[model samples]
Target: MRLEEIARRLGLEAAVAGKGMAAEVTGGYCSDLLSDVMANAKEGYVWVTIQTHQNVVAVAGLTSVAGVVIAGGHRPDEETIARAGHEGVTILLTPMSGFEVAGRVHALLSQTS
Candidate 1:
């Protein structure tokens, strides 16, 4: 599914709609640790995390994730938002926990597959 589709499906709010990101969601991955996310996230996949740091932008860039979803209603700080915008990474916020978001994403993917 597209990034916009995934966001719509999960009722996620867009925090930073980076250039080209809303048009690029293809898959999803949920991780809390930056290292694990950087290592496991695939290009075009939406990354779900509780982390609200600037490093999330770097990891998203390195992994080429389609977007970053900040779960548990958390929002990124100004610096993180700016970096994400600069890096072309879409940042989203959802009220659900990481596990809930991941499960929803998986269910959506399963339905589509």
Candidate 2:
């Protein structure tokens, strides 16, 4: 699945146009803790979390995540958006909870698999 497709399926709002939209979504990971994501999130995964801090962008770039879906209507701060754009990371916002986003992502990946 592609990042765009996943974003569409989850009704996400893209923060940066076309950024990481073409990246392949190999899987998804949901976690609010940066350390847990850094330790376990697989490359090419779309991360679902409520974290909107600037450092999340750095972690996404380092982990090579396909994109980030900020759940529960959370939007990244100005610095976070700038960092994400600079790092070529996709940031998506969703009104749904993290669990809801995770379930949708899991279903989408499972269908493609």
Candidate 3:
């Protein structure tokens, strides 16, 4: 599934940073720890978290995630938004919990895989 489709299917509010929703959503990773995401998230994986700091963007960029899903209706700060836009990181927003978001994304990906 593509990022656009995922957003639509899940009714997520997309707050794309740099690049548009062109990423191919491959896998799912749910974690609130920055280090865990950086270590475990793979390229094309949509990272699900509630962290709204600029460091999230740094980790997303470092790990090469397809996008970052800010669950539980959490919003990123302006600085983080600016940094993500500068770094071309995609950010998707949803009111669902991280576990729910991850499971839904996993289900969608499973269909494709």
Which should have the higher TM-score, number 2 or number 3?
Answer: 2
On the 0 to 100 scale, the lDDT of residue 7 in model 2 is 83
Residue-level lDDT of model 3, residues 1-113, one tens digit each, is 88888988999987874463778877878899998888899998889999999999999988888889999999999988888888889898999998898888888888888
Query: Candidate 2: TM-score?
Result: 0.94
Q: Could you give the C-alpha RMSD of every candidate to the true structure, in order shown?
A: 1.6, 1.2, 1.3
Query: What would the TM-scores of all predictions be?
Result: 0.89, 0.94, 0.93
* Tens-digit lDDT track of model 1 for 1-113: 67778888778888887753555556788888998887788988889898998999999888888888999988888999998878778898998998999888888877887
Judging by TM-score, tell me the better candidate of 1 and 3: 3
Comparing 2 and 3 by lDDT, which wins? 2
Residues 1-113, candidate 2: write the lDDT tens digits: 99998888767899964356898889888899999999988889989999999989988988988888899998789999998888788899989999988898998889989
The per-model lDDT (C-alpha) reads: 0.84, 0.87, 0.86
Off by over 4 Å in 3: none
lDDT: worst 10-residue window of model 1: 18-27
Local lDDT at 73 for model 2? 91
**Clash pairs, model 2 backbone:** none
State residue 74's C-alpha deviation in candidate 2, in Å: 0.9
- After superposing candidate 1 on the true structure, give the runs of residues whose Cα lies further than 4 Å from its correct spot: 19-26
